[model samples]
Target: MTGPSPETASRPACWRPARADDLPAISAVLTDPAFFDVLGAVTPEALAEACAPDGARRLLAFDIDGSLAAFAYLSGCDGDRPKLEEFAVLTRGRGTGTRALSALLEVLRAEGRASFWLHVVPDNSRALALYRRLGFGREEVLPDFWQTRNGDRVDLLRLHYDFVPAGV
Candidate 1:
């Protein structure tokens, strides 16, 4: 995808490799009440470890005007089909999340990855809509796929985004 348009230039959001120091902000976004139902529980320590360079996961933080606006967590980074484990945006309806996802896809394309996937709670219509808009297709619905902090099971919808190599 192309870069953000001039209209979004005023509040430019950029994506960068997440650092250990960003753990608190990542945790706050993950555990925010607005996303609690979709994200469940996430601790800062866990986020820090996951974002570590040697870990199986990689995290990209979206910054706007020097503050964390959102984050994307990818697992199985060493493999061909990495999974987007978490994508949370603290500042919603501002297009930050879309920009973050686009930046991530560019990174993955540069790394020669063919596709990636993510699982979302069935009730998260907003996220689902965004994913669809970004060319992600619904793969399947896995019943009782995610367990909440309260021990409740939630159905998950799997979405996949395949990268068609340029000119292919």
Candidate 2:
């Protein structure tokens, strides 16, 4: 759905940078079967390094009712164009991802970025629908872009969103 359900729409959004200690919780949410297929067998140590407090990347989390609801990882953050590396939402079909992503786009806009980009598996129509609804456009296809833990290579469709500052 493009819009969050009314109940979820009113819920508060708690987006914060993920600390080193948050890796376990983050790893749990991501390794669940709901997400494990796409994420593969990610380890906590790997998460710690990827989500390190260093300025090179931005790993943000979204919480609801004091519980982890979503996680977003951005790379190439030291540059003008940050790449949205990963987006995982524990709560789906509740408009959680949409709202969470909208919040992230605003953050990028506030950062004065001209644009941000992400890659999604072509088969993830649900995510593709959401991306398109949120103003992302297809850029190109990167063949064999993702290598899963099972030795399977996956192609990804690159999508990008250009920032539109408030009031145009």
Candidate 3:
């Protein structure tokens, strides 16, 4: 990993909109063995789309001491529904994903988002617990929701976080 582990690094105050230059490290993390199931395919083309001023796909990165440590991948924010496709840490167990993801969530809230959704592999118990602890409600099981690069079907647990509850 290019950056310090979560426990050793100073906690970042916030996340920033991902820039073109962040692509390399962001690519490295997403493609790393620890997170590839989400997507090892966050290509340059995709990064371009994410960095575009009006594109739907958005990338938010949190760095420590100028190196990439974590990033959140989101899409369709301008519409009624936004999906948090990935909120990944460069390493698997440094334990900073919660902090980074919390900061990233604020970025979305600042944009006037009322709610957003994410999906995680059912088997990733740690991630599931983390999201739940952060107040994401488990919505349902989306069976065979995705097909991996290896042509394997993966079922995901859909989760939702509402900044403003519906009945409020």
lDDT of each: 0.79, 0.78, 0.77
Q: TM-score for all predictions?
A: 0.82, 0.79, 0.83
Report the Cα lDDT for residue 37, model 3. Answer: 65
Candidate 2 positional error at 97, Å: 0.4
Q: Please give, for residues 59-85, the per-residue lDDT of candidate 1 as tens digits.
A: 778887667778888888888779998
What are the runs in model 1 whose C-alpha is more than 4 Å off? 1-12, 165-168
Global fold similarity of model 1 (TM-score): 0.82
Candidate 2 global Cα RMSD: 5.5
Query: In candidate 2, what are the lDDT values of residues 8-32, reduced to their tens digit?
Result: 7677787788877677777777667
Give the Cα error of residue 135 in candidate 3, in Å.
0.6
- Tell me each candidate's RMSD, in Å, in order: 5.4, 5.5, 4.0
Error of 2 at 107 (Å): 0.9
Q: Compared with the true structure, what per-residue lDDT tens digits does model 3 show for residues 1-168?
A: 386666656755457778888888777776676555655366768876887645688887787656677888888867756898777787667767887878766766787888889988887788888999889994799999887655678998899999888888
